[model samples]
Structure formats: C-alpha cells, structure tokens
Target: MSPIFMTLLLIVTLGVFAYTANRRWRLLMVGAADKRSDRVGDRVRATIEYAFAQKRMRRYPLAGIAHQVIFLGFLVLAIRSLILFSRGYVEDSSLILFAPHTVIGDVYSLLKDVFVVLVMLGTLVFFYYRLVVKLARMTLSTEGAIILGIIFVMMVADVVYDGAWINLRARAAGAEVTFSGWEPVGSVLALLFQDAGDGVLRCLAHVGFWTHTSLVLVFLNLLPRSKHFHVITAVPNVFLQNLTPRGRIAPIEDIEGKVEREETLGIKRIDQFSWKSILDFYTCTECGRCSDHCPATNTGKKLSPKHLTIDLRNFLYQHETALINPSRDRKGADAENAEYAKDLVDGVIDPEVLWACTSCRACETECPVFITYVDKIVDMRRYLVQERGEFPNELQTAFRSLETSMNPWGFSQDERGQWADGLNVPLISEKPDAEILFWVGCAPSFDERAKITTRATAQLLQRAGVEFAILGPEEQCTGDFARRAGNEFLFQTLAEANCGVLNGYNVKKIITTCPHCFNTLAHEYPDFGGNFEVIHHTEFLARLVREGKLVPKNRVERTIAFHDSCYLGRYNDVYDAPRDVLRAIPGVKLVEPEQTRDRGLCCGAGGAQMFKEEEPGDERVNHMRTEQLLATKPDAIASACPFCIRMLSDGLGDKERTDVEPLDVADVLLRSVEENVPAEQTAGA
Candidate 1:
C-alpha cells in the first residue's frame, strides 16, 4: 500500500467534504431559531428507539428489513474500514487488542465477514427495488443506482482484500490454506488465490484495498450533495423531533405586535422556517413513504409530501450563498436569488398543494425520521390567509361566520344548546359546579345530523348520572379549523374568550364529542391559558360503562365498522376507547376497516376542507375512506367525531348505501343502553 497516495487521497477528499459541510451548516443557520435541545433523556430514548431500532421503517416490511440490514452492516463493518485505513500506514493492520488470531480479533473478523455478505445482500435488495421493481413511491434516480453500486462494489473489495491478505499470510507460513470459521468468507476466497503467483496475489490485494479505501472517501464527499445526506442527518433529526403535543400547532406569538413591526406573520419566506424544519429538509430520504400514505397524494392531489420537501431543499441549496450572506439584501439580490426569496406559496409550492392536505398526520406518522408536514403546511397557510388575504374563497365565508356567530356555519349562538333541549342537559351557567363540562363543538351545535350525536351524548351522560354541564351558548369554536386554516388571529380571539368563560366557571375537566374540539382543547388551549383535563366523549362513555354506571342491556344486533378520526387516533392515540365502548354493547360485532387506527384514512373534512371545496383530485378523500369502511360489509359505520360522521354520511349517500347507517359511537351505544330505543325517542325517554 502507498502511504503517501493514501494520505493525499484522504486530504483531498476530507478537505472537500469539510468545505461542503461548512456551506450546509451556514445554509441551515439561515433559518429561524428553534429550541430542540431540552428533554435530554427523552430525546436520547427516542433516538435509540426510532433511529437505532428503525422502528417506523418496519411499516414496509421488505424495505424496512433491507434498510436495517444495510444499517447494521455499516455499524459492524465500520471497524473493518478503520483497520484498512490503518493498514495504509502500518505493517500490521490491526490494533494491539484486535490483532488477528486473538479472541477479540477473531470475533471482530467473524462479525466483519458476516456483515460483508449481509451488506451485499442488502444492497441487492435495494437494487431489486430500484432497478427491478421500480417502486412508484421511490425516487428512481441515477444517483441512487450509483450509490448502491458503490456500496456493493465496496463490500466486494473488502472481502477480496481479506482473501488476498489471508492467502499471502498462509504462503509465508508454509501452511496449507483451508476454510476457517473465524474468517469464513475470506478463507473460502483464499482457496481461489492459492495457486496464483505472489505477484498476482499482491496486485489483487492492492487493487481491493485501494478500491475499498478510495470509495469510502468518495462516498463521504457525495453525502452533502445528494439525498443520501440523510445518512448523516437522520439520527439527529429523530432525536430533536418536536416534543410538543402532536395535534397542537405552535401559536404565532404576539401576532398584533408582529403586524405592527411589519414582520412576516408566518412562513412567507423560505428562511422563515425554523432550523429544525431545515434539518427536516436535510434529513428527507426521498423514500416517498410519507407521500405513499398521504390521503391527498393517494387521491392524486398536487401535494406530495416527498416532492414538497425536495422542492424546498432544492431551493435552499440553489440559493445557499444568498440566503447565508448576512450582508446581502434579499430584495436587492441578483434575479435568481430574488426570485428564490419570493413567497413560497405560489412560487415554489402551489396554493392548491397546501389546500389539499387534510392535516391528517398520515405523512408525519409514516416518516421514519419524524419529519412533520402538517405544521409546515399550516405555517405557510398562515401567511397566505393572515398577511396576503389570499386563500380559498370559501374560507372567507367560514371565517366570517366564525367571527360573527362563534361557529363556522353562522348558526345562532343562542341556539347552540337547543340540540340538548329534550335531553334535559344542563348548561354550565345553570350548573357551574358540575363535575365535568361537556364542550359541545360547532358541528354538534349546528349541523342537523351532528345534533343527533349531540343529543345522544347528552342522553348517555344523563343515564350514567355523571354530573356534567354543557358550555352551550357560552362555548365558541375551539378554533381548530381556524388555526389549521391559518387564521391564527381568529383562533386566538375565540380561544381566549372561551378560556375566560371556562376559567370563570372554574371548569377543571371537559368532555367533547368532536375530535377537532377535543384535540384543540386538550392540546392547543393551554397556549391560551385554558388548561383542563380534556377527554373525548367516547372515552368518558367507555369509562362510565367500565365502572358499571351505565349498562348496555339490549342487543342491537349489527355489524359495525368503526372509522378512526385522524385527530383522535393519530393525534391523541385514542384508538381503544371508542372500540371499547362499541365492544361493550351486546350483539354488536366491532370490525376494523383495512386502514384503521393510526393508518386510518381521513374523512376529507379536516384543515377547513369541510367549509372549502376540496382541491381537485382524482377522487374525494372521504369517498375513498368510506369505500374502505364499506369494504368490511358492515351493517353500520361508526365514528366518534361529528365531522367524520357528516363526511362519512355524505360518502354513504354518494354511494347509495343509505341503508348502511352512519352512526356516531355515542349514537350506537345509547341505543343499547336505552333498550334499542329509536334515536329520536332516546332523547325524550
């Protein structure tokens, strides 16, 4: 081996990598500051679970196992790479403890040999995926092929070098070469070279050694320039993942003050994204797993989470110098950089792309690196709605209604409690010291079908004898849609006013039938000084049944397929409560849809899509979801959220499957408790 050439190769490649890494660091710093350093123990545990264990990757079994094999192989072969590097400068490649024939050395060599074979197998799997299978979800780039080729070739060279080294040593010792368990792969390969002359063996050894070493350096330099950069950033990104409640959108602090200062309200510019978000951009593996599970992308919407991240990353890289330059004027930059600084909504990202998202968290749930799309999508929407006043025209009417009537549909605020009129449900104003406050959300208060659920929930609570009262007219929209749709000002106004009322009543606990309201109240309301123990109504009802406070005496024989609300299931992980309540009812067989629980399809009512028309797609998300639930061939479809009920009911109507009733979990449970009473009669019974 030539030490001089090896040192020079290391110097050139390492020096280039250093320069590239420095530029990437500067570009990352261009983003706004984000705090992710807190919660040390939790972060380390998460890194170990998600990054090291490759937990989420297991969702795709074949690819998950293949990627994991390669990852573990890299860890095992790392020492072998270091040994080769040391061999360039020294006579003996191994350090003192790891010298060949020693127990530690033999163990290390055995592990290295195994991983060499495994790594090749792993690369072959990816080669199959990229070249043979040509998975639609993956980015089939030439760069990806080249990287895989480098890896496969590198593993081959390592084993060849080992084989050549073993043969030379055996010849020098005047011993016959044979298979050995310690260096199984190398010894088997050595048998092939035993008859070759020393000259040829030496040449092959040098070829293998140099190729593996040089490729290692070459691969290092390629990382920062390619999507393969995730190899370097994924671990840190997983560790620094947002620790806030999954459902809560971080509020725009001091919105009015920022307006007075004329600062960008949300992510108007690329650099407005936080450093963590920039790291997310860097960590994207382009595996397309996020977009694969995305309801919008699945339905052929313009928003592919994978492409969105890649586009932003490409933009950042393309204008790195301008963005990182402290002295450069963004507005006065060269034409290309000036264009790069333009609003991302229409320039880099289409507004339709933003509008198509359901805020379902499907992408976030599937991202192995914990790269979040919902928050970023909502942040950009904030700038469009609040600053530019450019959003879906339908949102204007919804926003106006929310502003005028404390509800998105402009239902009279005074009529909010009318849904519970026949059920004898008390208002918080009438029973301020009630044990729990039922926060009946906007849809339940106004929508006709949703009112049935509201009445059923009230009747259940009345039967259970749980001391609970409704906010009724005192309640306002929890602003879940407003915040998600990017009207932070309106959300905050409503959130504050509601908090004042709840605080005045000294409300310590809350139960809501709407998943959106449950999520907002349980997670987001804390930002508005409204901290209370929030529980979804299904959860409360389940607890009541568990405690024997309410019993399902009648057999309402039906096959019920339960649809999980994204806000409840993905956001809060409340999959079991509704199912438990459903299971408790006699003669009701609870079945799950093909896509259930965390992987459930969205009902297409979230992110203000209930108010605005869906962004054009091949099919409506709700229709697709409804079809999934219908595939179970159940007599009824059950869901806990009012929005989900409304959407699924519409989906049922669209399919002319009106005979298959769309019932709320409460609606179904109340029938059993009330001895199979008709829903209309249950309220008065």
Candidate 2:
C-alpha cells in the first residue's frame, strides 16, 4: 500500500463528504426550529429498538430479514474498513488487539468472514426484489442497483484482499499456504490462487485493496445525493420521532397573535415546516410500506405518503441554494426568491393529495424510520382552510355547523342529552359530584342510529351501579373533526369552551362511547388545560366485567367480527378492551378480521370525512374494510366507535348485506346484561 496515495485519497474523499454533509445540515437548519433534544433516555431506547434492533423493518418478513443482515453486516464490517484504512499507513497494522494470532482477533476474523458472505446474500435478496421480482412498492432506480453492486463488489474485494494477503505472507516465509480455522473464508479463497506466481499474487492483492477502499469512499459520498441518505439520517430520525401521544395532533399555539402578525397560519411554504419534518423528508426510505398500508393510497386516492414526502424533498433540494440563503429569510426575499415562496399545497403537492388522507396513521405505523404523515397533511390542510379559505365545500358547511350548533350536523345543542332520556341517566349539572361524566359525542347525541349505542352504554353503566352523570347541554364537540379538517380557529374555540365547561364542573374522569371524543379528551385536551381521565365505554365495560361489577349471564348466540376503529386501535392502542367485552358475553364467539387491531382499515369517517363525502377513489375505505370483516363470515360486525358503527352500517347497506348486522359492543352487551327483559326494552331494540 502507498501511504502518499492513500493519504491523498483520504483527504480528497473525506473532504468532499464533509462538504456535502455540511450543505445538507445547512438546508435542514433553513426550516423552523423544533424540540427533539428533550427526553434523552426515551430517545436512546427508541434508537436501540427501531434503529439498532431494526424493529419495524421486521413487519415485512423477507425484506426485514435481508435488511437486518445487511445492516448488521455494515456495523460489523465497519471495523474491517477502519482496519483496512489504518493498514494503508502501517502495512502490518492490526491496532495491537486484533493481531491475527490473538483469540480476540481470531473470533472477530470468523465473524467478519461470516458477515461478508451474509452481506453478499443480503444484496442478492434486494437484487431479486429490484430486478427479478420487480416489486412495485420500492424505488427500483438504477442508483439503487448501483449502490447494491458497490456493496457486493466491496465484499468480494475484501475477500480477495484477505486471500491474496494470506498467500503472500506464506510465500514470504517460504511455507505452504495452509488452511487456518480462524480465517476460513480467506483460507478457502487462497487455495484458488495457490498455484499463481508471487508477482501475480501481489498484483491481485493491490487490485483488491484499491478497489475495495476506493469504492467505500465513493459510496460514502453518494449517500447524501441519493435516497441512500437514509443510511445517514434514519437512526437520528427515529431518535427524534414525535414522542407525544400518537393520538394528539400538535395544536397551533398563539393563534390570534400569529394571525395578527400575519405569520403563515400553517405550512404555506416548505420552510415553514419544522426541521424534524425536513429530516422526515430526508429519511424517507421510499420503501412504500407506508403507502402500501395507507387507506387513501390502497383505495387509489391521490395521496401516496411516500410520494408526498418525496415531492416535498425534491422541491427542497431543487431550491436548496435559495432556501439556504440568509437573504431568503430577510424581508422582501419573497419577491427575489419567488420559486422558494411557492405554496406547497398546489405547487409541490396537489391539494387533493392532502384532502384524501383519513388521518388513520397507517403511514406513520408502517414507516420503518418513523416519518409521520397525519401531522404534515393536516398542516398543509391548515394552510388551505385557514390562510387561503380554500377547502372542500363540504368542510365549510361542517365548520359552520360546528360553530353555530356545537356539532358537525348543526343539531341543536339543547337536545344533546335526549339520547339518555329514558335510561335514568343524570346530567352532571344535576349531580355535579358524580365520580365520572359521560362525554356524549355529537354522533351519539344527534345521529339516530348512534343514539342506540349511547343508550346502551348508559343502561350498562346504570346496571353496573356505577354512578356516572352526563354533561347534557353543557357538553360541546371535542373539535377532533375541526382540528383534523384544518379549521384551527373553530377547533380552538370549541376546545377552550369545552375545557372551561369541564373544568368548571371539576370533572376528574370521563366515559365516552366515541373513540374520537375519547382520544381528544384524553390526549389533546391536556394542551388546552383540560386534563381528565377519559375512558372509552368498551374499556370501562371490560374493567367492570373484570371486577365482577357487571356479569353477562344471558346467552347472546352470535358469531361476531369486531371491527377496530383506527382511533381506538391504532391511535390509542385499545384493541383488547373491546374484544374483552365481546368475549365476556356467554355464547358469543369473538372472531377477527384479517386487518384487525393496529392494521385495521379506516372506516373512511375520520379526519371529518364523516361530515363530508370521501375524496374520489377506486373504492370507499369503509367498503373495503367491510369486505374484510365480511370475509370472517360473522353473524354480526361489532365495533366500539360511533363513527365506525355509522360507516360500517352504511357499508353493509351499500353492499346489500342486510342479513349481517352491525352492532356496537355496548349494543351487544346490553342484550346480554338485561336478562329476561323484553326485546323492545333493550337500548338497541
């Protein structure tokens, strides 16, 4: 090895990499500041689980296994690369501890050879995916193939260098090249060249050494310029992932101040996004796992989470010089750098793409690097709704209805407690000292079909001797729908009013049948000073049954397929409670749909889609989810969320599957709990 040439190679390649990385860093800083440095312990644990352990990648078995091997191989072979670099300066350098004859070195040599072979096999797996099988879910570009080729060649070159070096050493000692247990792969390779001359062997060693080392440096520089940038940013991205409750959307702070200051309401321009979001763009692996699982994408909607991130990232990189310029941040830069000031909604991303999202979090769930979609989509929608007054005509109506009547449907707030009229349910105003307040959501209070679930839940609580009271007319919409639909002003007004009411009553605990209400109250309300213990009815019922407070004695003979609400299952991780309630009923067999629990398909009702028509798609999301549940061949489809019940009921009707019933868990539980009661006396009946 030539020290002068190697030193020159190191200086030039390392210098180029440093410059490229610094440019990326500067671009990242161009976005607004974010707080990701807090909670060091939690960040470390997540980095270990999702990054080092490669937890989320394992969701797709073959690809996960292949990636794990390649990732671990890179880590193990990192030392080998460093050792190779050091040997350029000191020909016999093993850094003392890894000298060939020592036990520590022997073990490492064996591990290194094993991973070299494993790494090659791993590359072949991806080769099959990219070339042979030609998976549509991944970015099968020539660059991907080239990177894989570099890795494969790097492994081969390393083996060649080891084999030639072993042979050269034996020849120098005038001894035969004998196989050593510590160097199994290299020993085996050396046998192939044992018959070659010393000059040829030296030539082979030089070629192998130079090719491997040079290609390693080249690969290092290629990373920042390609999607392989994830190779550098993925771990940090995971470490800095949003650690707040998954269900809670970060609210816009100081809304009036921002409005008065004429600051952008939401993400009008790409630079308005926080740096963590910019990192999200950079760290996207383009693996399409997010899109594959996304309800909007699967249903042939305009939004593909992968492509959305990619489009923004491309726009960022396309205007990197202007965006990173300090002049761009100064006044009047908008006129000078008009391209950089372009609205992200219709310029970089189609408005329809943002509108189609269900906010089900499927994309976020499937993302191996923890890139988020809902927040970004909602932020863009905020710009559309608040800043530009350009949202779907339907959302405008919903917003007005919410503003006037405190519900999306414009139902009179005075009748909010009518659903519990005959169930002996008391209002919190009448019994202000009640232990828990039932937060009857808009759907349950106003929609006729959803009222049945509301009644059933109330009757069950009464039968269990749980002293719970309702908010009655004092309750307002939780603003989950408004916030998600990008009406931040309306959402904040509703949230503040609702919080004031609840706080006035000194409400400590709440029970709600709507997953949306439960989620907003428990996770989102704390941000507005409305902290309370919110429990979904199914969870409360499950606990009552567990504590021997509510016994299900009557036999409700039915095979039920429980449909998971995305808010309940994916957002809040409340999968088991509903299932537990269903299982407790005698003669009721609980079955599961293929896409149940966290992977459950959206009912197409979240993100305020319930109040508006779904964006055009190949199929309605709820219809697709209904077909999945129907595949289980259940006597009934049971769910806990009022919105889910309503959408699924419509799904059943649309499919003309009237023979199958769509009942809420409370509806089914009421049938069993009210033993020997007349059928018409039951809440559902």
Q: Which stretches of candidate 2 lie over 4 Å from their true place?
A: 328-337, 677-685
lDDT of 1: 0.90
Report every candidate's CA lDDT: 0.90, 0.90
TM-score of 2: 0.98
| Clash pairs, model 1 backbone | none
Worst 10 residues of 1 by lDDT: 676-685
lDDT tens digits by residue: candidate 2, 529-613? 9999999999999999999888998998899999989999899999999999999999999999898788888888998888777
* Tens digit of per-residue lDDT, candidate 1, span 326-401: 6675545464357567889888999999999999999999999999999999999999998899998899999999
